[model samples]
Target: MPRPFVIDCALSFAVAVSTVLTSVIAGGQAEQSPPDWVGYLLLTVAAAFLVARRRFPPLVMVLTMLVSLLYFGLGFGTGAFTVAPALAVYTAITAKHRIAGSAGAAGYLAVVLLADRVGGQRDVSEGNVWMVIWILVIVVVGEVSRGRAEHLRAVAEQAARAELTRELEAQRRADQERLRIARELHDVLAHNISVISIQAGVAEHLMHRDPDKAHAAVATIRQVTKDVLVELRSILDVLRRVDEAGEIFPPSGVEGIERLAGRAAAGGIAVDLDVRGRASEVPADVGLVAYRVVQESLTNVIRHSRAAHASVVVNVDDTEVLVRVRDDGRGVPGDDVRAGNGIAGMTERVEAMSGTITAAPADGRGFVVEARLPLRRPEP
Candidate 1:
């Protein structure tokens, strides 16, 4: 049997033995019939009801109430507190049947008080008043226990919700970090690789006729390769990072765009790079986006435009950074720019900084990529 059932069995035996002794003392003093076998049976049944208190607390409350009333009416003794009814009321109240438990307690008290008056004992004894107080104390004690249990449950639920929020926030930050890395890698590799590809083709073609020019082209290829390696290493360092606020990123901005334009100009293209406003005032993140836009636009010119000339204009203001790149090659593949790493990647970067970008055919010739990057990034 369960431990509680075993405990209840022991309690029932003790209460039965105690009631017999109390009733015998009352028979001599109060002129009441002492508890015989019939009274012993009633006491045993009332205490036995305590065994099922946990499973059916309300039912135990009702059953114990009825049995106690019947026993008290028989003029036996419970001069001290009755243990069984009090236990049943405690179980019911603590088990969350607070109202039913109160009713049971009230009904038991009223019935016992009525039984005393009906049995011609007009004066209520002090012990009887203490018994009534003890039953109310059990009710208050049970409510306090239930209140504590409820508080613990509420605290546990709040802790679980807080843990879940932390996990979701972590996941969101991880996704944003991965996306930043991807955009960086794409911008770095696409521009430099296009330069290297153009230089390789130049070196191959000029190898037979112009040996000096071919060697210079090969030299450009080597430099571009080294630049790509340095950038890739920075990204690797970011990946190996162990915590936040200590990430490694490429040291790139508008200041680096001049070198970027120089590299593109060396790849057999006439390029004019212009900055009309204070370039130093741009925020680091916005500067990075501007650099990427210029880089991607120039890469498209080198790979697709087939034009010998390109113009890159950067106009920085207090509110925004404007980038306009135009080439005198074929305007674009089509009127509407298709999605790719070229224009589409630039679009993603510009929009992420709460900026706007437009890539389409220019007025008469060439393709133009124009972007306006805000000074501040939007809130996440």
Candidate 2:
């Protein structure tokens, strides 16, 4: 059986035994007829009904009250016999059956008060006063228990909602971190690898006709390869991978745009890099993203554009930093050219920092990429 069933059974036994014994003792003190089997049966029924109090609290309270009233009205016993009924009414009140419990308690009090006024004295007796006190106690204690139960349930629900909010926040941060890492890898590999591809093509073409030029192209390939390794190591460092003896390479932000232009110029494309404002005034993150916007634009030029010249310009003001990279190549490709991931990555970065970017063909000329990065991010 359930633990509650066992407890209720024990409670019923205690009340039954106590009520019968007390009623017998009280009956002897009275001038009424001695206690009979009917009196014992009435007390027993009231106590037994308590066993199902939790399942049908209001019904149990009514049944217990009716039997107790019958027993008292017959002069079988009164004092301690009211205990079982009080307990039943308490269970009903705590179960939130406020109307039924109040009605039952009032009915019991009314009958007892009426009997007292009619039977012996017009003045209230000590027993009637005690009955009123018992009902007051049951209502007070039952209300307290119900209030405490409601408080605990509210606390539990609040805790669950807080946990769910924390989980969703954690998931959102994890997703943003993953996207940041992917963009980093794409920028580092695509730019340097495009350089190596161009140098390799130069070396392959000049190998038989001009050995010295071929040697220079080979040298450029070696230098570009070394840059790739250093950039890769920088990325690995962020993911907690460290080389015991490798040289650390700090990411060169806007300062490296000059070198970027140099690298492209060496690949036979005339390039110009201009800075119109103090780039250092902005946050490191803003500068880094500006650098990437330039880097990715140049890589696209080296890989796709058939023209020979490109220009990169960066302007910083108190509010925002602007980056513009234009190539004098075959203007933006036709409809047949499939889209590239670089533009999407750039857009994500700019928007994440509350910035804007545009990449399209210049009016009647080559392709142009422009991005405006804010110095200070806004509060969410």
Candidate 3:
């Protein structure tokens, strides 16, 4: 059985035993008494009805009242039988049936007063006053119990909702972190691998015909690979200590565009970098986004555009930074340009920084990638 049912059974048995004992003791003291068995039967019936008080509080209260009135009418006892009905009233009130409980209490009290009047009992007003006081005490206690139970239930619901919110927030953060790591990996590896591939092909082609050219190509491959390894290590370090306070190295930003231009130059693309404003005044995160926009654009030019000459323009203002990369190459078909990872990655990064990126074929020839990043970073 459930614990509440067990407790109810125990309480019912205890009340029944106490009522029976009180009636037996009272019968011995009364001058004119009904049979002991009659008192025992009536009180037991009232107490037994209380076992279902939690499930049917109003009905139990009514039944106990009727049984108690019957006991009083039969002249078995008055005081002892009141205990079961009082407890039933308390249960009914605690069950949140306040109107019914109050009405039942009032009717039962009136009946008790009428019985006293018929019995010619003295000090009837004083006795009724004491009965009212007792009922009021039980009502107060029941109200307190009801309020406490409601408070505890509300607290439990709030705690559960808080826990669920915390879980969802944690999952959201994890998903965002995973996406950031994937974007970083793609951006870091794609450009360097393209440079290495082009350099290796150059070295192979010139190996027999021109020894010096071949050696320079080999050197370029070594340099590009070394740079890639350094960036890879930094990315790995970030992944390992994501919760740490400081970065492994200063983030690559607009200042690193010259090195990016050099790498593109080594890959047989001549890159002209033009700066129009005070690039140094830009915030680190915004600068990083600007650098990435240029980097990814140049990588796309090297890998897809097949352009010999390209130009990178960076114009900074007090509020925002504008970056554009245009290449003089056989540009991509509209569909091919629309469906590429480089553009998607650039768009995601720019949007995360509350910036915007656009990639499209130029008006006459080649392709262009443009990005605008706000200088004042938003509060995280």
Most TM-score-accurate candidate: 3
Q: RMSD in angstroms, all models?
A: 4.0, 3.1, 2.8
Residues 196-281, model 1: lDDT tens digits: 99889989999999999999999999988988987787778669863445434445888888988888898778999998788987
Task: Report model 1's TM-score to 2 decimal places.
Answer: 0.84
TM-score of each: 0.84, 0.87, 0.90
Q: How much is the lDDT of residue 375 in candidate 1?
A: 89
- Where model 2 places Cα greater than 4 Å from the true spot, the runs are 30-35, 121-124, 241-246, 266-268, 333-338
Instruction: Estimate the lDDT of model 2.
Output: 0.84
RMSD of 1: 4.0
The total number of steric clashes, by the backbone 3 Å criterion, in model 1 comes to: 0
Backbone clash count for every predicted candidate, in the order shown: 0, 0, 0
Q: What is the lDDT of residue 35 in candidate 1?
A: 68
The whole-model C-alpha lDDT of candidate 1 against the native structure comes to: 0.83
Report lDDT (CA) for all predictions: 0.83, 0.84, 0.85
Model 1, position 127, has a per-residue lDDT of 60
The residue-by-residue lDDT of candidate 2 on 84-164, one tens digit each, is 889988898889897788788888889878886788854447767877998889878987888898899899999999999
